[model samples]
Target: MKNDVKIRNEMLSWYDAHARVLPWRSKPSERPDPYYVWLSEVMLQQTTVQAVVPYFEKFISIWPTVHDLASATQDDVLREWAGLGYYSRARNLYKCAQAIVSEHDGIFPNSVKTLKSLSGIGDYTSAAIASIAFDIPSVVIDGNVERVISRLHRIDAPLPDSKTIIREYAQNLFIGDNTDRPSCFAQSLMDLGATICTPKSPKCEICPISKYCVAFEHCDAQVYPKKRKKSKIPEKYGVAYIYVHDGKVGIEKRPEKGMLAGMVGFPTSEWNEDSVDNIDDDMSAYKIRHVFTHFALTLYPQIINQKTYNMIEFKEVDKIGLPTLFKKVWNMIESDL
Candidate 1:
């Protein structure tokens, strides 16, 4: 326990000196804003810092406050979030903002419990907002935190299952009694894990808390935070109808409750588990490919007759909103048309 305190102090001091000057970092005289913290957290999920920086800046520039976000149209919100992927995050972000507007009068909640009640906020996100935005002494355990804790204690259990144990360990090391800087502390741990104590080839020589890191001492820091094996993503095949009539293109809204829900895409059928032999008869044009972290989707781009429409909407493809995945499909059609 004493060692933990020592390590925490060392990490905090190092963080004070070396923390990255990110847009979200609060100035000495400025208080952390829950809205910015929440936005950054949601954008950073399963995304890299470099990839999220521009999007974060753009969002802040456009909305500027929770009330602004709440007032923005859903289409505008989704359009801004288009390239960010994870359409669900964008949808949930709008939902959360609306909830704040309706229930909390556009003010972010201060406690983890209340924050969790908002759409898309889970345990990690709630803790992050509570600690960073409100300085509430809550433990914010992200993937970086998990890595740092697992290495410090030389924990070898597979992650997700080991997350709770690691969170408890971090909770024990909290310096709430000495400082009202939980935000900096949490950010410091994240920076340390990301920059120095990385998952692969950790730079222990430059690490401030390496003296107390159990995994470092044991020469196994690289492998301490073990993870479960990833399951193979099954390949899938589908047909997309890129029907163009006059100067407009046909597009459809995905079902409201599945993958890529509520996003605009070319009309497509349910993906088949097996590779399709041919879609030439049913499609005017077709293409095949795979997406990262998802199954392979073959798009059978078909130019349908104008008389076949019943529920589909037609618009100038460039004028309508489209998710990145479908945007790629549109590009393919543009090359051919």
Candidate 2:
């Protein structure tokens, strides 16, 4: 066998024994469920596997199929997806499920073009669902795969710039096509990258493809996938109002567009750079600090005792969906009550 074939075989063999038993994955010989694959891939974007597992299980338990998910209200979907961050994914997920039912007759599209036409399915997600669920041979490159391929070939370029070459190298693994079960090979690379070829402190000694890895041969495998430094994120200050009346609390649904779209949260003044140190009130003691991908937020939580029309039972506020930012405010105050 050629070197690449040998490496592929080794990877498949390793995957057979050590594949991560995720709720969404199937054994090498079994066919994967497309709905599960699509849902899991969508949830996995900008989320860690460990963090996504429970959410995946919850979603599967609540909405077993695409049709069931499509039937759910957007508010219901966003409620379950509350703490998952990236509220946009939850919105798109609802839209995509409805599209799959309406546009494709509840069957996920097998081709990349058709899949990408859906709400949130893009290049990576489309390729992943196509290959893993439909057994269509395609290159599926994610962050983990990027790291593994960059190190294996010792690509000198930094991320984003190196992604093109990394994907090209990854495509080389699917050389033998369906006869080789390239779908399994795709997952094997994912398993290898996720478990063995990690970003930090890679376990080179136990890696199945170490022999073929250029960076490993040179003793600098961990440094193969280089990255540019990120600029410091800016800071924003805001104040959230926790209005209380007889036995209820005030709540608001954010605008359909902006930072935390469609998610439930306390009403708040617009975020700015000013500090809340001057605005002294008893409820200001519960300060909330949250960090998003673009900026950090410091929220001064003010609990005002006033009757408001849009109110829910204060005791039942925990049942509704609130983003992590507002959840922090609830956590601090809930402890007192």
Candidate 3:
């Protein structure tokens, strides 16, 4: 841990040469727009970088600035944010935009406390925005940072319990003056953990700071940040009524609360583990399995003859944006055609 100088220098030098060319990223020494940084950070939460790029670009093109986003309607924002999952992020995102415009005069707050005061901006996000966008030296701890710190020190404690200690280590590792380097250093850990120090089969030979990694010296880096056995993920069941007439399919807006709230999805029965028995299996019924963070969902999508339904053309369905769960329903219906 005395090698902070070595670790920070090597990591930043590598970052300058090999930072990912993301749509929202500025160069290692350069600062990105705060709006862009905030939006990208929120979208990147619980979603992969690969999945967020197009949506990021689309949002940028559509709403260009905080004021523009603030003026946009909630439905429009949620529509654009569909398939990105975490519909609540989209809702809170809209609220955050309005808050920034109304309260902060369309400017992002500079401090962690002020940023967290906005909708959907939590501890990790506030720190990320402060360091990366505003060039404030805030400790940014994410899953990737957790992995790198856990491996760098070879901490054997499992996650959640180990989070505080890992964060303390991260705080020390990133210690320095409040400069542009903090931004670059914050992103560098993300880049390092993502590309080189991956979860499985990390590329230690190419790692810049492998010389300083205790786990690498012991030849068992992956075993650090030890994890406990994950409990069994319970399964939930429901039926999706894919009511089709003409060349279009039926879709409905979910109620304003619970899962997939305020998003467009196929009409269905109540989701319950016990409801699995009530769905009679017929030739037209196709079972689709979709996994969420907390539980796995098995949806019995059936072609039901129903009168109350909103129709959208098959070609225009993706344009309207369905959640990945309902997109699976569409895909199933298409394949059977």
Candidate 4:
């Protein structure tokens, strides 16, 4: 335990001197805003810091406050979140904002238990907000933290499922006093994992905790956080009906639930292994393939000549906001024309 204390103190000191200048970090004499912390955490889920930076900036500029976000229209929110992918996160973000307004009087809840009760606020998010916003003593175990902990202790359990044990270890190591600087500690661990103790080719030479990290001492950091073998994603086929009329394209809003929910996309149907039947109208077939995080999709772009379909709306293609997957479909249609 003495060694653990030494490790923690050394890591914190390194962090104080080396922490990156992120937008959410508070200035001296300024208390961290729960709203900003919550918003950033939600946007950062499954997204890279580089990718999320612009989105976070845009969101803060547009909404500015929890009340502003809660009162904004769903369409406006979805449109702002258009290219971010993971539409569910956007939807739940709105829901969470409204929840805070209605239940917590537009103020972000300070306690982990209360924050978790908000929509889309999971354990990780709650801990992040509690520590960063209210300066509460809470352990934040994000993916970066998990990797750092797993390597530091040389735990070999596969990722995701191994998260619980990793969290337990982190909780044990936490030095949470009443006035503990949980925010700095949490972000420091994350920064260490992200920059130094990375998943591949860790930079242990400059790591402050290298002396105590078991994986570094053993030179097996890459092998500490074992990952389960990923199963091959089955190929699924779908048809995107591209109806062009008067130099405009026809798009439909996806259902309010499920994949790509509430986003404007090309008209499509359930995917199957076999080709679509009953070819209607004079349309040329183009093929495009795309890969989601979990599935592979093969889209058969059937271009229906504008003469046959009267139920179409046309606007300059460049003016439309389409999902990335559907953007590929549009590019295929334009290139083939």
C-alpha TM-scores of all predictions: 0.90, 0.95, 0.93, 0.91
In order of listing, the candidates' clash counts read: 2, 0, 0, 0
List the candidate 4 regions with Cα displacement exceeding 4 Å.
175-179, 275-285, 307-320, 335-337
What count of clashes does model 4 give?
Answer: 0
By TM-score, the candidates rank as 2, 3, 4, 1
Error of 4 at 324 (Å): 1.0
Candidate 4 TM-score, C-alpha based: 0.91
In candidate 2, what are the lDDT values of residues 1-337, reduced to their tens digit?
Answer: 2566788789888977887888999766678889999999999997789999999999999999999999999999999999998889999999999999998899888987899888888988988888889888877888878888788889998987987777677667664432376677778888888888998889999999999999999999988699987999888888888888788889999999999999889999988766665675454577778998988988888888897768998778888988888888988886654
User: What lDDT tens digits, residue by residue, belong to model 1 across residues 58-140?
Assistant: 99999999889999988788778877888889989999999999999888999989999989899889988988888888878
136: Cα error in model 4, Å: 0.8
- The window of 10 residues in a row where model 3 has the poorest summed lDDT is 171-180
Q: What is the C-alpha lDDT of each candidate?
A: 0.81, 0.86, 0.87, 0.80
Query: What tens-digit string does per-residue lDDT give for candidate 4 at 1-337?
Result: 5565777778779988998878877874688777888888998998788888898898889989999999998888888888788998888999999988998888777889988887788988899888778877787888888888899889877887798888777776664322246777778887898788888888989999899889888988888688898998877778888886666667778899877899888888787756556642245366678888777787878777664333344444544567788878877678555
Q: How does candidate 3 score on lDDT?
A: 0.87
What is the model-wide C-alpha lDDT for candidate 2? 0.86
What is the lDDT, from 0 to 100, of the residue 336 in candidate 4?
53
